[model samples]
Target: MIRRKDTRRMAKRPTKPTKSVEPRRAGRGPSPEKTAQTRRVIIDAALGEFLENGYADTTMDGVARRAGVAKGTSYRYFPAKEALFEAVVREKIAGALIDADPANRRPDEPVSTFIRRTMLVSIREIERNGRAAIARLVLVEGARFPEMTEIYRRAMFEPLLKQIRDLAATARARGELRRPELEDYPHLLIAPIWFAIIHNGLLDRAHPLDIGDLFEAHLDLVFDA
Candidate 1:
């Protein structure tokens, strides 16, 4: 006897749905604030390296290490050590020049008074703000690295000297200065500042002369104020 085959079809089981995943986008670049912060850190690190090791000894690797950044990061911001040094001077030292700009002088303000208010204030903060250290670095390494010296001279010295000359002419015109000698020898006004810097930094650190006071005394002699 042949058995009749069952004609009923079995129901199929349901399969679990698969989860969809989106492809990740390429990593984004650093934000502007982060980039600026990194640049600032590199500059500060470079200054420290220059001050501690001198320009000849400072290296991009050392600066990057000091900054706690990858070597490539520092190089990305400054292609070479010379560029790093220039950045240091521009950020740390050149800003002080703004205070000494003759254009900042108010109308009818005596040149001596303007100097007292502006340059004097900057001088007082030099040692405290690390400018004195940078100046010493330039003095010590200038001969070997003339390019560094030129950077400093162009960024600071030339502009400052021109400002002094202009102010000297203004002082004489205003009768704040009685002699035209200052117009000829404007360095006379700033000689004491250099003396104080050298004295305090090199000659006799044990007996540091207050640069601000020394500069003010020189002002009195030059302007007879």
Candidate 2:
């Protein structure tokens, strides 16, 4: 049920943070809705630049050009290029965090069913959000942008890890899982999703593996009775 659209507004950060742009000097430059929309356009365009050119090559000018706005306008919305990168990565982190929320699952759902659906939500996010490009960007530039990596880990990865840990705890309490180790090692439950991402994103030319099949086998292996 977790779709891509639900991810953008997940965080309530103010969209119009810097001084008003577009020369609306009489104070309130643009309507709140318009300001938010412009900020989103900038974020999307910056994502394109970052995805295509990588971190080092992407520039504020490129993002502004892609967004069809003046470079000053882009800077008005985002104080620096790193701010744009933060915006680009924020949506992905939000999507992952939203998918990890246990409330999204149906009440009293079977553990296996809930787990499958949860993983599928993430899969859909990846497929819909060009996650492959972002993954590559992070892998290539993560050492330089430790803050970005920290943002992603704290906002998305750690939360999702907690969710899986919670699920494992519940299953263990209910005697559904014979493997108490799952509670201690919930990372094992989600490893295959990354493996699938690597296959599809990095090397699908020669070793194309169906993601659905990979997840199914992951579940069977983990939920072994």
Best by lDDT: 1
Task: State the weakest 10-residue window (summed lDDT) of model 1.
Answer: 4-13
lDDT of each: 0.88, 0.76
Once all C-alphas are superposed, what RMSD does model 2 give against the true structure? 20.7
Query: Looking at candidate 1, what is the lDDT of residue 112?
Result: 85
Model 2: how far residue 95 lies from native, Å: 1.2
Off-target runs (Cα >4 Å) in candidate 1 are 1-28
Lowest-scoring 10 consecutive residues by lDDT in candidate 2?
A: 92-101
Off by over 4 Å in 2: 1-27
lDDT of 2 by residue, 1-225 (tens): 865777667868778768656854575568899989899899889877887888889899999999998999999989987777777777744566675566776777767788777666566556457665676567668899886677666666677788889888887877779988878987887687777777777768477666667777888877785
In candidate 1, what are the lDDT values of residues 80-160, reduced to their tens digit?
988888888888998888888889999988888899899999999988888888888888889998998999998888777
Error of 2 at 11 (Å): 69
> Which of the numbered candidates is closest to the native, going by highest TM-score?
1
